[model samples]
Target: MIIVDPSSGTSPDRIESFSLESDHSIIVTSLEHHVWQELEQEIVCSLKRLQCPRLLDSTVLLLHKLITNIVRTMHRHAFQQAIEDDLNIDIVSKDNVFDELLQNELNTHGDRNIEQFCRKNHFQVTLTFPEKTDTLIRIEYPESCDSSAYLDSKLAKAIGFTLLKQTDTITPAYYCATVVRDIAQHHPHLEQAGHSELLLPDDESDKVLAVFCKLNYGIIVFSSAGDILSISPAILNNLKLEISPTSAHTLTGIIPGHFYNDVLWGLALQSQGGLFENYRIRIRLPHDDSLSILFNISGYRHHDMTIHTLWQIVSLDHKATHTLAEGSILNEARVHNITRNYVPQLVEQKAREIVRLGGNALLNEECRLAVLFCDIAGFTSYVENNEKEESVIHTLNMILGRITKAVRQHAGIIDKFMGDCVMALFREPHKAILAALEIHKHSYDFNNLRMRAGKDLLLLRIGIHWGKVVIGNIGSSDRLDWTTIGDVVNTAARLEKNCCPGAILISETLYEITAHMDHPEIRFSKPFYLKLKGKRNKQAVRYVQTTSQTLLHDIFTTHHAKG
Candidate 1:
């Protein structure tokens, strides 16, 4: 057993690379949730921006999730134990390893214990948590043929914590299991009914499934009596794209939605108890069972009146993707099993992109990548001078709306949009450089409109850098973001600061690359050296501006002038 108690100043990012397979059971504690969450978002952003999974695979991402779950769970247990001891609530969340359950002092914390118990233990007890969240995770094995043995009685009845795994493997299993005993020692309000089955709240059920689908499917929800409750935007976007070519190409137009009511209604009504168990259903309209939209629907009851359910709908192409290696059709149970494990939305989206690329987009080697960082000139002053929040939002959106279009036009990924800045990544260095030049032209168009409306001009400053940076996910669980890190990304942002209003700056490395490209739009104003802030040594840099021809072409090509 090993214990790691990090000091207050220690960065949680240091623990991001924690190994899943360990020779020793480890207890990691004391990291604050807020700090860890911040680090996680940074790592997530980097991993997504870099597309690290193509090389590092999904294991790194999964390990992140495991470590985070451990830390969060451990914290909760310790907090709960302290709370019970202090409040005298008659509630006890005992720390139970599989070996200790038979001897636990189980009482009725009621069925809530079932959830707590199932969250932490396994039947065979191949793995058990000391912190449950921190010390133990069974990544080595994810399946079990039989259920673990345990005694069920009043004195041993309370199962404190439970979290089940809904995976697609043959050996589907549970994460944690334990018994919680009420002891009837306190808290009269919680024991009014004596024992009530733990049902997930309406909002919570939707939340858990939404979290699950982040990396997985397009979900369709239906009420118990066959009413459509909700539809994900992704499905709706897919339907629109399929139904009409004249559909607007705005990125927002393609939101997920699930309109397949017949399939969902069938699943709910067929469920024995007002709830539909986890099962698979074919998505076919009344006139068309031939369409290959197969989805896995899992049903749960919110208030005994309505059945809330959703499916992991895979094929957005309106064709079937449910065939296995053996050429056999995937059954309902099998489909549900496969999708049981939570897959991040980014991962699934990336996977589909690779598929669309005909499997050649996956790259592992260091590619000469370009990082572009753009910010609104004097955003703080713009906000401070403009007292109305509405004007600030309107102007900011107007600028961002134009900037985002410019970035995508050049095949760049807007890694993230900060309050008034955006970070874009490009495999082609020139695109990043070109994107910067085009953005300034766009500013002119917006300024033209603003001048007509008697408003202040909004200027743009952009910085571009060229270097090899890794794209790797850094944080735990679903709280991940896509970003790229390294000197290149940092240097680009630094360059942006040095840029003049309505101008673009390029690092020496970027100048060397673009200097050779044949484009009349790019012009550099001789190399110079500067002792940039926080840097000890002088570095070579160059200033750049695109010609009218370039901006005009971009304007006419993509119709970027916002009306």
Candidate 2:
């Protein structure tokens, strides 16, 4: 097995160069550009255009793969140029924004607009190839203009599989070094990408602090006076520190050691927290003189309240020049299964996680509630006759937008949207009824607006019921939905199906709760014992129809008052 060692720029700057006794002639070259501006532009433009939250990962991966392929092509071009210096070797770079990689996704997936598809649902993405090759390529994409947070290994792997033109998998160290390089150069923009906290010392002891550091990675410790207390062979070799560790080696004895004390002691004395205690420094190479290695210094306190610093080292060159050879790789179905599972998992772990609140959802609570279900009248026919997908979506969104505003105005929360239907919940029965009334009142105007625009007028039906409900987030641990679920929820759906167009139907439980309200314009249809679908017994319910609004109040005023 090839082991990782921090290097001083002999190999490419992506992977830790490995040497085996049998094959020692491996040559490496670093491609000197963070090219592919076309892909970056597409990423920035299409970010807002995407609809589903899960597809965000795929979008990033697609762009990353594009850059990776270009880089691989550049690496091969560099090799050919350096060794062969051929009479004529043309790469013929294309300017098309959606080039070969994107075209392959279109052909292999479908003819739909990739951006629009991403807008509708979570699309599966697998940059990892089923076929294998020996060469591995590493790529790094900027997370943002000002953040140290970069995408993790899974993303790097996806880019590797898709763009390592002739590789089985991306070697980890190759890509991780890209992260290290980024952190070093952009020290001001720290990588706070997710909730992963930095290593902390539990006990207030410098020795105990070093205990945890050694468990994680190699570390070198030094006193506040800049004297070396302990050293790890890995870090010492990586930095090529000339000073012999005699427990009295002042940090200033070394070259860039002047900043070493400031970085280590200054932060440690200022704050007891992890945020300010971290620092990055680069050391010039003894051999090349022009090249350097980056080291990360972190500070901690001992039981005696003494400040101690830790040193972690990484190589500057991370790129790799893999020798192409045949190897084993996964199949297409395996890749599909892998991709299908991964995108959703990422959404659950990274996207849904509330970063500020430490992954805890804010809407977890129980309350008495009024559930409302509303659906479009003859929606199936509207969809079936709709020839243009964009038109159908536009019309549907227009209606939902109006309905959502009405509910929100009346202190109701839209639980979820189901195709041409929505389920909302309210804590007050009057507010729920008023929300339904708001929909009826505004729809007439909505239909009129559509008619003037030469569009067919659509109708809506609403059903409401009130009962005790756990009005918070509930679902699988990873995927949570902020909605309510109880027997009363089902009854509201049943009432909506029984409701007529422009009518607000409510269960008897809801009627009894709101019967005390002194609303002059509100009138209920004759209360009758009706056997709703799937119910064995008859139940008391009422249908609320539009009478008149003598109050002449706006939708906002009606919400705060009786309807």
Candidate 3:
């Protein structure tokens, strides 16, 4: 550890004689060097034993600028003269001031750490261990009005270069700010709840932020004070342009109608083959601010569905109102029960309706990737032989609920569940692997909890594979289901069959993706070959082992206390 000593009339020669012990050690002194003319020479002499040429080069220029600015800003000449006169020193030098600043940075108060110093002083301080490529930087004043505006102006100027015409297009930076502003304004109750300020609140903000950051997702947040917070690591390995949420071409999901109408019209529309395809509707206002009644007639079958939902936003207030207004033709409908099994599908369909209303036409591109297939091992025997139907169903639901929670925590979308089997798709390979990891980890905890309750523990076998697969509407003309299909899906199921109870079996594709990820608790067995059904080549499968010390264990302790 570096020891920072505040200058208390220590001579320049004595300060120079102080030994630098460790590579991590540096003696920061606050001596007002009046006699020493060359600051670089003094630092070099002290750091001679330390073979840090790069540090010297990097710090010399930055430190010089900082020290010179500080000297000029603080009018150190007069203060130095008074101090030198009192201490009987010859003159003040640059080395003295530089050492003082460095010392101050390394100081430790009783309970106040270095972070407190940087925060209190509003400094952008970064400490790097060049050899290890490790860096820890405390960026202070991001919450301050001044710093936020400065960052915004900087980001705006950077984004301005990409935009052809300011009026025609919103730059990536501006779009990020706009989205952040919208979230903040409309969702004031949603606080910034993550390791970073830029993260948007999801169901579980911390987990979401961790997964997003790990996957190299860039985030930008807008403060209520109109300041922008953006963080993008310089080196993002294999990160694609489409992964960024702020990208103009990136797709977004939305829900337009109120709770009741949203479920009914959305479900009815999906039932009549209008979920993914374009649909038209007309909006006739019921009252000024009471509610907006709209009618959506299916485009595929021309089946009419009525929706009544409260409108919280007006056309004049929203800049993208024209987009919403142009595509949608509105009609009035009575509100009724919309809640049913297919509610989320309606929510997703409502997102499409917003696009129909003329918001930037939502992209119809299919996200193709891996899906994890999971099922409880020996579930049929347990259900038929031992447990009652209701009890078995309850246990199955509990297992599904626990697994789904883990899957969603890692940002995996649940495709569907057949009996005790779960089909979840991750559009990205990383998400798929992470979801598998979470599932395996959670299953152990769930089983342990069941064991404690004197209930037979249900073992889950998960199979994950990655490949191109179409993700869009499926099913008959009368009913549409958003799902995925491909050879990868089949392989995932086959891999699950090979998996043992309480194990996660993954295809070669999944193992490859998660090979080097830092998951200490997860143990992977050596890859084995399996002759899968209808497959010419033998498939490679590996099982993921988990224990009680997992995410599910923590969640159970935190949430299942009452139960």
Candidate 4:
């Protein structure tokens, strides 16, 4: 059993040195009532001694539930192993007999047999305090024991219940950390035992493809010989294509005359591993109306060296038609490069928005949004002082990656990244604050790594505000930038500029909205006034405080003392 004393000034590098420590180990050899009572008493005393009354009851209850389930599962496995050894046969082949004997022994003997069995196959539980803020419980089983059974059992349900019950009491960071840790521990077992191979069979793949073709876009599959193999109903309906008994089912015969030559040329180019996309054409409809369509073709080579072409046709709106008519269609190679490189950086919501809007027209609208700005403190000095340009850029990207992840996790849209700052927009005021908290937490870890490496620690200052903002395209005709504008954006930036290092500053407007919600993790100071730039009157604001602030301070103090 290993336990690190929180008051010992133990760093992460020294964790392995304390592996032999056994100050927090509890040995369980039976499930009898008196044993549980004694164990609970010890746990209660420990909690009291630690002065962690906030988590006392919940921790006790959760540990009890978890241990109960674990012990039961262990006993069942041990019993099966005993039967198999005595009978010299696989227990699965004697399921009925094993079940009858198991029931009789459990109900009649009442832990007498299981208690003796557990005495030979016992496990130890150890409790550790991580950063003196969270509890880490570990159960260690013997080499011959199968601990995976307990992990795969009802332990997750117990953890879930504890989290739900303590939602309003525990911090969000702790809650998320617990959930993620549990998932990571069991993920390998889940993949090996619970889930099947991810790749679908041929029939399943065909069924999926059939369903996918029924969506809004038109799909057509053809062979290298220009023979139409399959086409979606959407294609025929949207293009008003009618098939007669005498009509040939070939690309040349079925395709419209206006775009047949272009389609053929595109397919020929695709055969040489060249991409063909954004080929625009006009399809004449009834009543002299015309519809603009964009074509994207992809080719797949089969094992038999046969090429299968997949053609996608998207109908364009009036705005997209005008934009395309202005000769703005990108070259196929540029389109391919952009899709492969830049498109993946877009968030899922932004990607969907672009697809829905057909990537055309000015998206000018006024909506109430929460704006967040995050800037790294002392970054300029660090960059100027550090001669290793590559290391500086790497560190900058690492920090920016953490901030980007936090915003994306909270469903916020990243507007842009300035030199040492990031701007994001969120629809929910509470989520924006949550994202800010997450960014600071991640930065704390980064700073710890930097401190250990004898590098200067980087701190972040964040600001969030909620108000109506204009979000749309703003730039020259050649290069348009999709961003947020209005006083709200300016206020968020100003707040960030005036914020203290390693802290978050939020306007009262945002504070009021989030304070009314069920977010006990977020705490704020008394209302304060700030003379923000470009404003006639002082703006009302508050300093956002979190439990992590204390943790960060402890780390800083400990590191500096050691230095």
Can you give the TM-score per candidate against the true fold?
0.39, 0.37, 0.39, 0.45
Stretches of candidate 3 off by over 4 Å are: 1-341, 344-368, 386-390, 452-454, 546-563
What C-alpha lDDT do the candidate models reach, one value each?
Answer: 0.51, 0.52, 0.46, 0.60
Cα misplacement distance, residue 96 of candidate 2 (Å): 69
- The parts of candidate 1 lying over 4 Å away from their true place are 1-349, 353-366, 549-563
Writing each residue's lDDT as its tens digit, candidate 4 over 429-479 gives 789988988898898888888787887777888999887676555688887
Model 2 lDDT tens row, 110-132: 22233223223221112111111
lDDT of 2 at 377: 77
Worst 10 residues of 2 by lDDT: 320-329
Candidate 1, residue 395: Cα displacement in angstroms equals 1.9
Position 130, candidate 2: lDDT: 16
Best by lDDT: 4
Give all candidate RMSDs, comma-separated: 22.4, 24.8, 25.9, 22.5
| Per-residue lDDT over 1-563 for candidate 3, one digit per residue giving the tens place of the 0 to 100 score | 12233334553213322333223233211122111123344344333433333344333433333333332322233334444666787553457674474345333221123323322333321111122211111111112112122222233232221111121222222111110112233344434534355545674788866775654433322222222223233111112223353531121111233412433435334554433222332232222323332222222212333322111123232233333432232321111133334444323653554343233322222223667889987778777776643576677777788888877887677778798898887645656766766776677766676667766556667788876454444566677665666687888888888776555678766667556667676667788888988899999877665454345544444433333
Query: What TM-score should be assigned to candidate 4?
Result: 0.45
What is the C-alpha lDDT profile of model 1 across 1-563, one tens digit per residue? 12223433443322322332343233333221112222333334334443332322232233334444444344344345444566777444444542143223122221123323333332112222222221212322223311222222221223111223434434454233322223244333434544666657997799877787775655444455454455556554533333332332321222222322433444344556545543544434323435545555565555555656554665445543444211113344577578844443334555564454234232222224688989987789778977574478887888887887888899877777789998888766778877877787788777667656755556788889887565545465657543466777788888888887677888887776656678875678799987677667776888887666345334432332332
Model 4 Cα shift for residue 379 (angstroms) = 1.3
Model 3's C-alpha root-mean-square deviation from the true structure amounts to 25.9
